[model samples]
Target: MISGVLISTLKAQQASVLQLRNWRTLNLRRTVVSPRIAHLRHRHLRQKSIPVAANIISEFRKANVRCTPSGEKIFKQAYAKAPANTFSCSWELYSPLWTTIRGEDTPDSLCYRNLNVSSARQWRSRQAYDICISFKVYKVWEALYTNSNIFRQLIDDQEKDCRDFSRCCMALQPLWLWLKLVVKEGLVERGDVDQLPEPSMLRDVVIGSGDPPDAVDLGLVNPAMCH
Candidate 1:
């Protein structure tokens, strides 16, 4: 009887040890696999969204510029004497305005170099006036989306939130700026701007719905959210 009781006790201890070992192995697997699964999920979503985003951008590029209410107001104010039925500004003229705005001198150089008309007759020319008004209106629109403070915060947060995704965010910045410009200019609807996919973690911050206090202060939030 003593030998049998000893054998039974030994078997019970062995079973407890095995159970503990199995639990630890299961936990270890979970620890290792969880992050990998998360990373793969992120990559999958990004891949799926890319082609859709590219198509949207391609369509936006092909679409002609149509002034929003704000853009129309800008146009009328800039060309009060011109006929109401004036045609949309040609892309040839509009394209150079972006280059000028991105330049170091910016509005100063834009004003003095392109818009400095020596006479009222020079100002009266539609081509010259188009350049001036387009620059002025776009400059204002650029500030709305590219607030220096908000952009700096975006970079900082991108590094903190996900270092791996930072490079992707940097690459997308120019495209984002272009999208914002078209939206503000009334060339594209705010709904269209919302279709561009961003990383799940950074989407709120980029679109101005995140915890960044500066976004609200600077009015850097995407206009779509307000509606």
Candidate 2:
């Protein structure tokens, strides 16, 4: 087991790298006020704030900080802040720095960029799974109408409450799904799971332990043992 001091230190480090911010300063969400469906294209590329949260949540999962619910909450909050039309309304065309949860640069954040862990689960999109099973609104913004400017304001101006930022991220469910498959294929790793101490079973015990809670690729075993 990791010592208490180490855990604290690790958490502190993660906190410094994994943060949410008030992105409500500049006006990213600009439109002519028309109901044009074509206007809302691949919204993620257009807005920096929502993706900023998306990147943060991906980092959290890499860190393994109960990100499923956390991601869901942040999505809901962000959705509340966005305008009533398509979610692509916000645009932080200038900001390049992505902040951490504790309000610092995210250079130290974990990188499970590939999504390789089969044992892990990701937050389902509001459109996919019922929120009843999902965690409570990370904050009130979770339930906000997608068309509200509040959703856009939170990302361009200031950091909405942690939960509020989470709300906006709800729209990025597909991104998480892609990560899951990529991680499972050994393309990426979650920081939390990777950072976890080796299981007691792996220490001195032989292979062939009972089934792991999550699927493990049997091929990873030593070739000599498989025969």
Candidate 3:
């Protein structure tokens, strides 16, 4: 009876050892496999996102727009007056510039055509307004583009705020449209587009003061507002 009991005890200890070894093997496999799976998932996501970002950037480069010398000067002056933390030009800066550009003594509201004044007096043509706003938009973009560090920061901020790279790219659409309008209005010559800042230098800017909650809309140059 004693011999049998001792044998039984020895078998039980051996079984426990085997069970522990099997458990360790299983745990070790999980530890190794989980991270490999995670790495592959991360790489797959990165691969998927790269093309979308590349396409957006490629499309943006196709705008082929540049700021006029006068526009560049104006942007420089405005940038100088802006706060150090200012990432984009504001309407406060643009408004005064517009007034100066218009050379009008009229109230700001009237100058912007916000008032429903009598039609008896001649007003600026819609095309004229379009050109003016488009010029301003082009200059703002040029200013940002020339300052590559700020431009990249602006894009990075937009990406963080939206948490979507595509949406960050979309924020640039209004600027692109306004740029195309600048080209359409003959403000920028086709030859000048070739001289635009490098594609890597491109970035987005708000046409007005304060950062919006999401993407930067058309601001003063909204199509509906233009019409």
Give the per-residue lDDT digits (tens) of candidate 1, residues 12-55. 99999999999999999999999999999999877555432233
lDDT of 2 at 217: 24
Report lDDT (CA) for all predictions.
0.41, 0.34, 0.46
Ranking 2 against 3 by TM-score, winner: 3
Candidate 3: give the clashing pairs.
Answer: none
Instruction: Judging by lDDT, tell me the better candidate of 1 and 2.
Output: 1
Residue 208 lDDT in model 3? 53
TM-score of 2: 0.18
Candidate order, lDDT descending:
3, 1, 2
| lDDT computed for candidate 1 | 0.41
Residue 209's lDDT in candidate 3: 47
Instruction: Give Cα distance to truth, residue 189, candidate 2, Å.
Output: 13
- Alpha-carbon lDDT of model 2: 0.34
> 122-219 in candidate 2: lDDT tens per residue?
43454332242122122112212122344335433323322344433332333222333223222222343344443332224455663431111211
TM-score of each: 0.24, 0.18, 0.27
Backbone collisions counted per model? 0, 52, 0
RMSD of 2: 28.2
